[model samples]
Target: MKNTYFFLLVIIVQFTNAQDYYFPERNESWQPISPVEASIDSNKLDAVIAFAKANEYSGSRDLRIAILEGFKSEPFHEIQGPTKKRGGPAGMILKNGKLVTQWGDTKRVDMTFSVTKSFLSTVAGLAVDQGLIANVDDKVQSYVWDDTFAGRHNSQITWSQLLQQNSAWQGTLFGGQDWADRPPREGGIDDWKYAKPATPGTVMEYNDVRVNVLAYSLLQVWRQPLPQVLKEHVMDRIGASTTWRWYGYKDAWVDVDGLQMKSVTGGGHSGAGMFINTEDMARFGMLFLKNGKWNDQQLISSEWIDAAITPSQPNVNYGFMWWLNQKGPRHWNGVGEDVFYAAGFGGNFIVVDRKNDLVVVTRWLEPSKIGVFMKNLIDAF
Candidate 1:
């Protein structure tokens, strides 16, 4: 009987210790807490960082040239955007809302590829929150009467479909071909350009052009620059630094409300996307970790975050540009199924584990070894 009572006491203490985690104030540095203070094994946590450093990406090739090589066969328009000098493997891990561990230069800015999709999806959610978008199921053409969304197939595409990347949106945007953005290597140009169109919401394709189309549609909805909207609505609210910038292709600029606005790309596929630091990325993840509530204000609605992480019908492991650890296509080894993350090319990731109150942001780690690093980190808890 005494042993049972002692065990119950231990459980209660553990549960209570995890509550009332810290929140960083705007324009203030994040408070750091030792791993042991957070109830995490310090040595085991060290092992996670060592594993990441050992498995760091070793490629020395120029990122821009590599991007061009990947799309060499496609008829993609050549466009140049800003890219910063990238550093080696760097990251930050936050546990219970406190900075627990970090390595490398967390402030060095680098290009975040597809992770921009998650930000773009957040902008769409903001539109929904403002009532500018009545429903995600409504046809996008109803909001923007442009030719990019016209015709039988494209007209049926919905906002939700675009958010899920299954819209199969057919059109050219910013001088890039929809079919040629990231076509299958098994097929030729003719096969890609003239392929039969699949019904929107039935197929999942990761074409940057389709994502750019979504961006263009979003620009029309906001009637302003996306960067400005993001700053006023999300970034400034979260206390992110002013160094970050979002870019579109050279030819992506268009007149909006008598002012020229650049329609940003969803990723750095053909160059021009989000350039951010790991610290800012960690803060973004922490916001989602707290269900979009930062400090005392709710930046994004809890309902939208819930729906954003819910698996789409076409892809069970994919949400609103976020990758979910569902049972289907993608699965993290020991993490809960509710774990979701924002991943970019070249191994940048913002992993959020709600079950454990953990948020991890990594840059330039080996892509294949992410699972290993995450599994090791979770095991430490």
Candidate 2:
């Protein structure tokens, strides 16, 4: 009789604890809950922050130099967009939709590099939700009839392939070559340029030039600036701050709907992507955490979110530009398979663990240390 009573009491307590969590309101001041209250080890959280600060990117202070050094063999496209002086290690950890802990200047707007791809992917998802994009598997050529989607091989590519980084679309955009951007170390220029094409959906290659092409193609589909599309459909709806901005290369402008519009890049690889603060990023992650719903409203469809995180056939760890923790070679240790994240070049990440009702946003940490950091963080619970 005593054991039955105790079990009932435990169940009641767990239910009450789960009910206590709520979504944050859209405002500059986000409410925070104590780590103890959220059932997270305060000591472990502090250690994670300390480890991030101690081991940051020491490669180069000058981002342009860093970019050049990272892509040594590629022909340089002089950076035509803006870059800010990056802040120190910063992060925010949210438990059950409330900010549990944060470190450094979380408001500092910094270059998010490839994290922009996730945002770009969300914009694409929006199109799908609106019925603008009929289907993911539908050939991109059906929507975009330009030479960008032309040619025998390119026409075979689908929207799903582009989202999965498996399009294998060969072309030059914004003065950058597909082969030159992150070419394989084993191959020379000729090998990269003349490499035989793989079937569109059979290979996964992370190329920013191809990503930019997707961005450009998306612009044609929407017939408006993507930033505006995002603001109306996602950001403004989520109550994101006005400080965040998405940018494209200087040469990426095109006349759209009788107006000159600049097509944004999917990342800051060649110096233009989303410049957003950690707080805004947290909100974005929260939206995904809730499966594209904010509060009582559904901003992006739940179906779209499901497809966005579903593992691509070619790369089990990648899905619609978002990284997935799946049964694959690149799985995140100690994390749930349902966990998905937006990762950038400089270790910027927005990790969303839906099973645990958690979201972690980290900036400027060493990329290699992420697995250990996540392992430690999960163990703390």
Candidate 3:
């Protein structure tokens, strides 16, 4: 009798833990919980939101003006795709997949610069899951079958290297030169152009041209538009609204399988990436927080999510496009090192804290204050 009683107790505990997560249904309002219900200090939660609002990103709301000013130092840099005027401070805090609090207009769609890289990473993950690409460590040149990855240096890059932003691919794509994108501040155009390129997988460099190269290479592998692949595979599975759009440069089109398709950019550095609302961004974060499972279906494999957040060989705080909160130069002092996030320019972030079963999505907060903002939010629990 005692054994049966203990078995019942175990089942009750397991069932209660399972019920803790609340996945919102498609086309329905996301249910929100009070700070008290979520076991978060109400005043502290309010302070976190207030701090986010006070430290609004100082860049121009008109991203066109902001992009030009931000990248003016880069030689021949110009907005090549589309730019949208951004809304003011907006965010959503989810505890155990339920909305705990939100501030500003969470429904407003806005440009999500390099945060798009995380989504692109997901696309690559899907390709691996579906067996389109044989392996992450395989040379990208094998799949691309073009001059893009033909040269000695470029041919050495692997899909993993490109995802980690250390491919050091030397070339121009979509009118943006890899060397010219965020070139060393000390160098002139000729100096940067002629400098010896770093070997692939040896260093991490943030360059949109190389990121675009990843997008383009993936286009060849999939033989279709990346946005279409993402939409059909990820966004729709997660019940994301149809509003978000991914874009590449105006001239980034190519003929694949006898059909014209525009290859998307992995970021908005040259002015195009993902334009998405905060709620959808939160959903994406929640998907990762749950290890890529949405309801009963595994939208993306858990193995891919694990590999995506694992530290790359070159950068401890960087993984396959996603940013890690590992103990490094970029570490957030008081935050859990296990936390990983999708970050972008102009203060966009989708932070996933698996330890706390939390997903925090913030847009347009001052970028420098992010560490402190996260520290404060964590303190509330």
Q: Which candidate is the best by lDDT?
A: 3
Ranking by lDDT: 3, 2, 1
**What lDDT score goes with residue 227 in model 3?**
91
Clashes per candidate, residues 3 or more apart or on different chains:
0, 0, 0
Which candidate gets the maximum TM-score versus the true structure?
A: 3
Candidate 3's residue-wise lDDT over 1-381, tens digit each?
999999999999989987888778767788888888889999999999999999999999999999999998988888899999999999999998898999999889899999999999999999999999889999999998779988888889999999999999998787888888998989688999999999999999998899888899999989989999999998888889889999899999899988999999988887889999999999999999989998778899999999999999889999999999999989999999999999999999999999999999999999999999999999999
lDDT of 1 by residue, 1-381 (tens): 999999999999977764556677666777898888778898999999998888776554366765666567667546456555478899999987789989998888788889999999999999999999999999999999668888999899999999999999887777787887778878788988899988999988888888888899999999998988989998988888878889998878888888988999899888889999888898899889989888668999998999899999999999999999898867877878989999988889999998989999998888888888898898898
RMSD of each: 4.0, 3.5, 1.0
lDDT values, one for every candidate: 0.86, 0.87, 0.92
Assess the local accuracy of residue 13 in candidate 3 as a C-alpha lDDT between 0 and 100: 99
The CA lDDT at 5 in model 1 is 100
**Residue-wise C-alpha lDDT for candidate 2, range 114-205, written one tens digit per residue:** 99999999999999988899999999999985788889999999999999999999888878888777777786778878998888999999
